[model samples]
Target: MSRELEALMLDHGADGVSFDTIVAAGANSAIPHHRPTDAVLATGDFVKIDSARWSRLPLGHDPHVRSRPGRRLATGDL
Candidate 1:
């Protein structure tokens, strides 16, 4: 899921990821910067995906766009 979000950013003209994508689900959702694991999401799990993308602009700090895009993809039966 995070990979797809990165690809979508790249497709939209973003040079690359400014910060690592956060795909926290269920209890992990409480953590804003949780690292993703191999656990499967459940039906009642609350999910949050925070991602930032940047361009190749020369500046003191890279210009970034932070967002939370939504996707409804199921890996298995609920």
Candidate 2:
């Protein structure tokens, strides 16, 4: 899933992921910084995605370089 997501981001023009992709399911969902395991997702399990992407623009190119260059983060649960 992480690989797919990374590909998707690259395909969409993101320079790169800002950090490691996190996709936690069930028990792992409670952890904000869980190292993913090979656990298979089951029905009714809580899912969490903490995703971030670096800027497509080069550093110093974006006006808000410090805050915007590599700080995009998005979290979601299901």
RMSD in angstroms, all models? Answer: 4.9, 5.6
lDDT of 2 by residue, 1-78 (tens): 767877887687676677777788777787878786888877677677766666545566762211122222223443
- Assess candidate 2 and give its lDDT: 0.65
* Cα lDDT computed for each candidate against the true fold: 0.72, 0.65
Error of 2 at 6 (Å): 1.3
lDDT of 1 by residue, 1-78 (tens): 788878989898888887777787878888867897988888877777778776775577655544445433333345
Candidate 2 ranges beyond 4 A from true positions:
58-78
* Residue pairs with backbone atoms closer than 3 Å in model 1 (clashes): none
Best-performing candidate as measured by lDDT? 1
Q: lDDT score of model 1? A: 0.72
